[model samples]
Target: MRADACRNLDTLLQTGAKVLARDPSASITQIAAEAGLDRRTVYRRFATREALLVALFEAKLDEAERVLDEARLTEAPIAVALHRYVEGIVPVSRQWPLDFSSLESPDHVTEKRRQQLRARLSAFVDRGVDEGFFRADVPRTWVRKLLDDLVKLAAHSNPEMEPPKAADLVVEILLRGAGKQ
Candidate 1:
């Protein structure tokens, strides 16, 4: 695809995410209008609203995979990897805010990718625990859930916060609970 076409597709996806996030029933015309592109442009790429939604989810997964790869979780020091992952993912969580659990019938490929991402994250957490960055006593599932919740909270609740700042806040809160110590 041409550069301009790619830009338009990206714009459409980004706008679609925002519009659909606010109102899942939003139409293609509404998304196109919000994206400042012709409705035909969107129609040319996406035959139906569901296609656009799937594309959005795929895009989110792509970004997440990219962030995870960039963080080098397996090779980097546990603390550095944790911070890098948080910093990279906060913006992605903000940009593609769709909740995968809400999908009625997600595509197999998407679901597989999502599971792969989760496994990678779980492994990273385990590494952190082994390295003494995370408490070994805590259930790994709880730690993972807390990380996910904190990232979502930072991204959605503090919309104005920069990604790095949000990452710092999340890391601090995760590593050190709200205690007098």
Candidate 2:
């Protein structure tokens, strides 16, 4: 694709995420107008609304995979890995707010990637427990869920906060509970 086409696609995807996040029922025409692109352009690229959503989700997943790779969860020290993952993911979550659970029918590749990411995360939590970064007494699933929830909350609740700041807040909250120390 040419530079202009790539730029236009990025604009459409970004604008689609924002508009659809605000209103799931938002129309393609509205998204195109918001993106400053012609509706026909979006139609040319995506055959339907569902196609646009699938592309958006795929873009999000691609970013997530990159973040996970950069974090080096298996090799990095537990604290460092946690912070890096949170910092990297907060922006991606904010940019593409769609929830995978809401997907009507995820392709096999997407589902496989999601499973791989989840397995890696679960393993990281197990490692944290074994390494004493997390208490062994706590359920591993609980810890994983808490971390996921904290990241989502940080991204959505504090939209004004920068990713690093939001990450710091999330890491602090996860490592040390809200209770007075």
Candidate 3:
């Protein structure tokens, strides 16, 4: 494809995501219009609705990573950092479009990102243990898994659920397993 065509494709994908995110029922014509391109141009890049949705899903994941990076997680207190990270993830999960069932299905890229986040969060908990904020006996691996499982559980199960409450429950469970000094 030509450079201009590639640019148009990117524009269409970006604007289409915004359009769908704002109104899950936005039409192809509406998306193309928002991108300042014609329907034919949009279709030239994305052959089907599923293709568009999948691209948008991938874009949303990138946006999530950007949000996490901007959070500056390492500078804050462990609990504070964890809360903010979980809080950031909550809104993303709630906002993510779920109309496309296949696109919403778990993908390798998504799993890898989640695993990376788990590692980072587990490290934070381990740091807390070293600093005496968390119990000494806690396994960092469990802390990591709890962050992944609980935040996701809250997302899929309850959009109206409080993330902090979810975080608290996860923290309590892990701490109990670790036992007090």
In candidate 3, what are the lDDT values of residues 44-76, reduced to their tens digit?
Answer: 777877677777777666756765665556678
Ranking by TM-score: 2, 1, 3
Candidate 1, residues 1-181: lDDT per residue as tens digits? 9999999998999988888888877899999999999999999999977788789999999999999999999999876787899999999988998887546678888999999999999998888787778887788888899999999999999899998898888889988852113
What is candidate 2's lDDT per residue for 24-129, written digit by digit as tens?
8888999999999999999999998878888888898899989999899999998899899999999999999987754567777777888888899899999898
All candidates: TM-score? 0.92, 0.92, 0.54
Candidate whose lDDT is highest: 2
Q: Residue 62 of candidate 1: its Cα lDDT?
A: 98
The weakest ten consecutive residues by lDDT in model 2 span: 172-181
Candidate 2: segments with Cα more than 4 A from true spot = 178-181
Q: What TM-score would candidate 2 get against the native?
A: 0.92
lDDT of each: 0.88, 0.89, 0.67
lDDT assessment of candidate 3: 0.67
